[model samples]
Target: MNKKLVSMFLAGAVFLGTLTGCTQPANEGKQGGQEAVKVGMVTDVGGVNDQSFNQSAWEGLQKGEKDYGIRISYQESNQEADYAPNIEILVDQNTDLIWGVGFKMGKAIEEAAENYPDFKFGIIDYAYEKTPENVVGVVFKEEEASYLVGLIAGKMTQTNRVGFIGGMDVPVIQKFQYGFMAGVKKANPDAIVDVQYANAFNDPARGKAIARQMYQRGADIIFHAAGDTGTGMIEAAREEGKFAIGVDRDQNDLAPENVITSAMKRVDNAIYEVSKRLADGNFPGGTTIVYGLKEGGVDIAPTTSKNVPQEILDFVEAQKQEIIDGKFTVPSTEAELNAMK
Candidate 1:
């Protein structure tokens, strides 16, 4: 076994022992003195602190613990194969609700949900073809948000060449790529956009290599939907004195000077809301919830020193409203994006 997997297993064993007996809340709740809901999460390879959806999902658990009086714990997966073991450990701990924090864990979560029929499970970024009776799939209109940032990249690029780096070739990442590229083209029809896929979300070295190549190719601005890999893009932008856009969260602080903006996907809100439903005895099981710009599930980061012109900011805002009001719809697939042009 790999050292990282072994370490993750040991960590899971320790976490399981720690949470074994005390999975339920100690204090009696105001509602009929019932035990508090026990919520746990299993992270993807990115773990909990990747500063992406995994981190955002953990933050939601934290918020649930703080405000909703739910007991929370988590197990971090070191690789794709670790998803089942991590979730199974949480199940053994008697977690009432378990959240799998990435699309890659969809099958694992589904199997777990079936194996543990009494518990509720949630999976992010994936909607199963046939959701189990005890599962909810949470997804976002990531392309909608990415389109906004693409507009920024389109308007702000000094070299008339922009780029997009994706973590995986999955539809979720493709949404970010296609939407962003469309936005850039919408703003500057003549602009050139270069696209690449790192094929690994956690490989910062690969991300940096691709980002550097794009920068060298005269792409003054780059947008990355590569999770932790995107962090490498930010680093390259800073070193090369260029601009990069972040995804899933406001990552401007990663490189304030270089990160002009971020395409926000409110994974935290989705996690929190779903956890709340479970806690409130309103579990949205066997359902796929789609959150979009109108629901505040997707947006551009409000903070950062992009220093874009007021007109540009206003234009983006207007376009955002247009999207919400059905005046325009952002394409979510490569084929649709190509047809749009």
Candidate 2:
């Protein structure tokens, strides 16, 4: 009836279609100019609240969320079997990066990396062979940190005897023991170090038992790298009024009066740094990232204002700087141990 009016109606319909396309859910503008890149972490068997490696890794994720506006989430594996599934969940979600929090998850991470070559991954404490082009292996100079702790233990022991309790009899644990013994020897050659391993990450009872045995054997101070197992060591120290050193995190607050210090691994920092890189599109892949004293990856906790002598605190601070400056190298390998002899 009216050709011009029909043409105008068609034009209006085209305009409405354009508006609908612009308003589509997938094309709608995001709240923050860009969608937040999600970061996911799969924790080791000790879980995220273990107050150790898992806790540190979670802290890094939190830091990334706060600093870079990232979306961070985590899944704690209660069993070794859950590792692969948890990693798969993250990868399926299109997470920008997936962090595998401990050496125990190395195999799972390797599998996930191979299956999802386009996704980025970061694994702590171990590296893999035939790794995809999108994985970063993060390890630490734990022996160097443990050596410093040994020096402290050696110097502070009134009985000239100390003890070390490790979570497992792995090479990583050996590094801690060797470094500690070397540090003790460097500081007080006459001092004795009693070393033991619990062989489990979650057994606090075994840790306490070992610490009690060491204490009965004239050990005045004990250092534990046993994850949750170390909690029992601190408890033993508190009950007996002996000294205990923590690992991975600042556990001084756990048993304030009994815990002299902790061998800090700065796992939190490593996680945050990697997550930040991923957010910035600078994801580190096909490379191993080793953080140590110089990178603030490891150190001793601050001496609290109680029980710690001012002179000892000063000495620790001085030695810390020396280690950072490379003036003092802490022994880590069999050859280094032999050189100390």
Candidate 3:
């Protein structure tokens, strides 16, 4: 594809148009209409069923299989130590492309890509300062989506106080928290946001404890960037008759009554697009691909709670458009958020 066509493809305008219609077997990996591609993934400690990014990435590979007849496989990591070995398993499987989900696997993906220089690799939530020739960094502007949802929390908070629960204090999760606080501050300067970290993405008990504490402290709504730990926050919100915001996927179904909405990062689209690129002989390796609001990479979930006013939703949509139009830029760091005031 030419430069203009490639730009349009990345922008999602021509993505579906560029896919091939060949009915080849999924295990073959080739370029120039030569062979089918086999894709594999390694999940983070949250596992593939975390109902978060990991699951989204796996779903994307499955989508590639359904749409383009590409083979797909994945290994679920039980802990941080399992990242490297799990990646090795995929590499040994002779996967045409290997995707490592989460920032925790950045180094592992790098090392694996280096060790197996002939293979292509991709990782989510990580942008390497010095990228490998065979690896692509797939990242998203999560703060933009978080900011949109933050508008809802700021507007709908009955007590003028909201809460944020994070899975860990890492940069990715911090981006979500900081953007959320910025949005709340923008929508309602007087709205106070309480922030806490579970330090573990899978610890639901800890998520519940912090969410409950925030609710007890006059917070009527809570937004969580934690993985499975956020599930506990959902349960807490439902039990306390409060509201909660979800992350990654559209988790409103988890507790439709209490979940106001969710900040969604489209990991599935990113993965599937990369897979298509590789198959189309347009693999984007040795660079970082950033999917932001303009690219439809992130947004608030469609499901809305009855408690949220339609006017508020309309206002959020306006803000989203403003961001895309370059009128507003969401903050992704503590200093940027502080400087905004």
Candidate 4:
């Protein structure tokens, strides 16, 4: 007697199942449309607040959040081993972009990029040999910036001797050294340029020791490319009443009296610009971006609150424009330096 009703109920159940299945894709589409874009960063071995490269990259991510309304997060890698895992964490979180900060992370970023082709990645200061389609390499014309600093060091040195302390022996650091030496040679042909490598980013003691050695060797001003190591050099400069140039961020605030000026990297600017492009669906991949003086990617800091002589400050400002306007070209290679001479 109830067969007709039972058959009807079974048909109703089939209809409901079909409707649920059809609604699933639309619901997924709606969720995807409403999802917020997220960006994450993994710092290099120097960690996030090194007052150097890592710090600069993190500053860019912060700016991206503020300007683009994207969610941003970061992980500071205390050791080299942490690079891949930290990037994996961001990928697992479904981050739209993961920035691997510094040359130390090149291998990790390369490996991760291969494993996740759809995930976008960017690294600062270095590039991979075999990078994925979604990866962007962000490098800098560091030599260009360092060359300007070298000019300052050459002219401002009272002892006619200047020094450069690098964090590691990488090509990136060498670019800074070579550029600086070239600049000094151009400005003061008689000036002596001493160079050394700390080999580690976190050792302040080593930085101080190197700076002291350079100072004792008759160098009056030292330019440091070391991360925390540079802090030690700045400290030594302050104690000895000499001058030290800062790097990456505007480190004039660290020791306002001793830091003559910082060779600005504009890492924050790079991060912000990259994230903005990615968020706008104009992601720049498979191309390496090299930012320099004209793009405002690098420059020297303004005279600090300590009041460097107005005359010297004015001269530096004028020189900055000259470099940007193509009037003065900084050399990066030994060959270029010789050519400039």
**TM-score against native, each model:** 0.91, 0.88, 0.89, 0.86
Error of 4 at 25 (Å): 31
Q: lDDT (0-100) at residue 37 of candidate 1?
A: 88
Predict model 3's lDDT versus the native. 0.85
For model 1, residues 272-319, the per-residue Cα lDDT tens digits are: 999898888899999999999999999999873365677788889998
Model 3: residues with Cα > 4 Å off, grouped in runs: 1-35, 305-307
Q: Find the candidate with the highest TM-score and give its number.
A: 1
For residues 1-341, write the lDDT of model 3, one tens digit per residue.
54334334432421243322111224455444655788888888777788877878888888988788788877777788767656665665578899989999999999888788999999999999998989999899999999998999998887999999999999999999999999999899999999999999988888999999999999999999999899899999999999999999888888888998999999999999999999878999899999999999999887864557889988998999999999888999999998885
How high is the lDDT of residue 249 in model 2?
86
| Best-to-worst ranking by lDDT | 3, 1, 2, 4
lDDT of 1: 0.85
lDDT per residue for candidate 2 within 77-99, as digits (tens), equals 77787776667656655677888
Q: Where does candidate 3 have its weakest 10-residue lDDT segment?
A: 17-26
Clashing pairs in 4: none
Writing each residue's lDDT as its tens digit, candidate 4 over 24-86 gives 010011123665578888877676778887788877877766665777777667677667656
Better of 1 and 2 by lDDT: 1
